[model samples]
Target: MSWYNTSARQLPWRDPGTDPWAILVCEVMSQQTPIARVLPAWEEWMARWPDPTALAEASPAHVIIAWGTLGYPRRALRLQECAGVVVEKWDGTLPRSREDLLSLPGIGPYTADAIIAFAYRERTTVLDVNVRRVLARIYGEAAPPTSLKAWEVERASHLVPDDGEAASQWNAAIMELGALICTARNPRCEQCPIAPHCAWLKLGKPEAATPRKVQAFEGTHRQARGKVMRVLRTAHAPIGVEELRERSGLPEVRFEPALTTLLADGLAAATPGGIQLPIE
Candidate 1:
């Protein structure tokens, strides 16, 4: 906790007394997107939505536009859907229990547990990438595996502090440690707060056999979809289906899936004249 107090980034989501809904948004936005990109988007997103009731009343198109190049736009749709439930069923107060949170759309075990620990300050484990890396280095004595094993989860669960306040502090502390000093690439082991206890460091710090690859963006269907979204977001009127195809410039093979995704995810609506963002 001391190390995290000194070393942790002053991220907005981690600010004192942040709302549970905001924490949920942070967890979802940061799932696949990098934190650097998520920060500004989060600020804009909070300013726009502010609460679940506000987001539930928002148009799907507006939600997608607010997402803006975070990638995996479907998550934006899911977040809106989740907000609807929070407002309609829970009366805009996100449920405090883990089971209730997990039942919400886009709330998986990790996200549910995170909300419990970070937002509610409940005794719960947050097994995010950062926490996993720290645990792997300390106990497993190796680089964190790409896929979490059952044993790893079991071992980690036991480490969660039984007390609510202590658990929250410990959870945040480990995550901050892994994200900074115990980083995946170029870990600063010398300055690590728990380096003396890190088994991987004692074993000479071997690297993972395979390095993670960055996904290609150019000419991919995802890029085509993004282009399509940008056009729809900025358009004053609906665009013809034919015009959308030309504007997206995607091959028939790529175009079909991207268009289907936009429609299926409710990012676009087909009117008699053309296609545009969903109407409020």
Candidate 2:
């Protein structure tokens, strides 16, 4: 915890007494997006809707527009849904239990655990990509951590302090270390607080035989979806089908699938004219 206080990155979500809604928003936004990109968005979002009731009352279109190029526009829809559920079912309170959090849209195991630990100060394991990487390098006997391994969660839970307050700081510290120092590429081991104890460093940092596969973005359904969303964000009213087709510059075959995904994911709405982000 002391290591983190000295080295912790000053993030808006890390502010004292941060609401669970803000924590949840940060977790969702940070998925697949870098922290640097998510910070300003988190700040702006909290400024606009600091609690579940506020976001629940707002339109999904406004949320999508405010999300602004975070990639994965569906997260905006899921976040809105999550807020609405919190308002309706939980009485505008963010649930501290992991099961309750998991029931919310856009929250998987990692996010649910994070909200419990960081927002509610519960003694729980937070196993995000950064946490996984740090633990893999430090403790993995044979291979780097792949996906969310069951053992990793057990190990992380073991590391958590018995004291709730200290444990919360410990959780945040390890995650912060992973984010700032123990990066995936070009980790600054010399400056790392835990480097001396890292098992990967103890052994040579060997390149894995099978490299991780990168998600292809260009010329894919996701790209087409982004195009459609951009058009909606810029359009003042419901855009006609012809105009959408023209603006997206995507083939009819690709456009249909992308549009279906968008609507299915709650990112867009169909109108008599065509489709648009639900007007707030």
Candidate 3:
């Protein structure tokens, strides 16, 4: 906690006065995306839609365009859906309980726990990739499993402080520790606050028995989809199929499948004019 107080990055959402809606936005934007990239986008997004009411009223096209290069554009649509639900069902106030948060679109267990711990300052186990890795090293003497296990959740739950305030701070501290000092690729153990107690470090930092699988991005359908979405986001109006395909720089085979998936995902829509971002 002391380390976090002195060393943690000064993020806007960490402000004590930040509302749960803004914290929810931060949590959504941070998933699978680096904070550096999320920072500017988040600032602009908040400036445009400061609350659930504002976001709920925004067009899907506007929301997706505002999402920019966050990679998973689907999350932008889901966030807007979540905002609509918040406005209509919850009367524009974010729900406090984990179960209630889970009911919101785009919110999973991790995001729910994050909102509970970070937004409401509740005593809940908040685990992200970084926190999971740090805990695996310190307690399990190895990297986290390819998938999270029941035992990991149980252990993490058992470790949270009983008091809500302390637990929230602990969650933030551990997550920051993992991001800064206990990173997955090259941990700076010498400077880690918990290095002395880390089982992996004490055991000489043994390598995983099997190498973790890395997901390829280049030359994949995802890359093709990104190209198509970029074209849609930049277009002044609905673009013809031929123009979209040519502008995306993807071959017909790749472009067709990417467009199909984007349409199915509601990230894009087909209209009389042509293909464009979803208006609804």
Q: Which one is best on TM-score?
A: 3
lDDT of each: 0.87, 0.84, 0.93
lDDT (Cα, 0-100) at 123 in candidate 3: 97
lDDT per residue (tens digit) for residues 15-65 in model 1:
888999999899899986788999999999999999999999998878888
TM-score of each: 0.93, 0.94, 0.98
**Whole-model alpha-carbon lDDT for candidate 1:** 0.87
Task: Name the candidate, 1 or 3, with the larger lDDT value.
Answer: 3
Comparing 1 and 3 on TM-score, the stronger one: 3
- Poorly placed runs, candidate 1 (over 4 Å): 210-214
Q: What's the CA error at residue 160 for candidate 1, in Å?
A: 1.8
**Candidate 2: worst-modelled 10 consecutive residues by lDDT:** 140-149
Alpha-carbon RMSD to native, per candidate: 1.8, 1.8, 0.8
Error of 2 at 194 (Å): 1.5
Residue-pair clashes per prediction, in order, are 0, 0, 0
Tens-place lDDT per residue, model 2, 120-189, is 8878878877777888888744345566677777877888888777777888888888888888788898
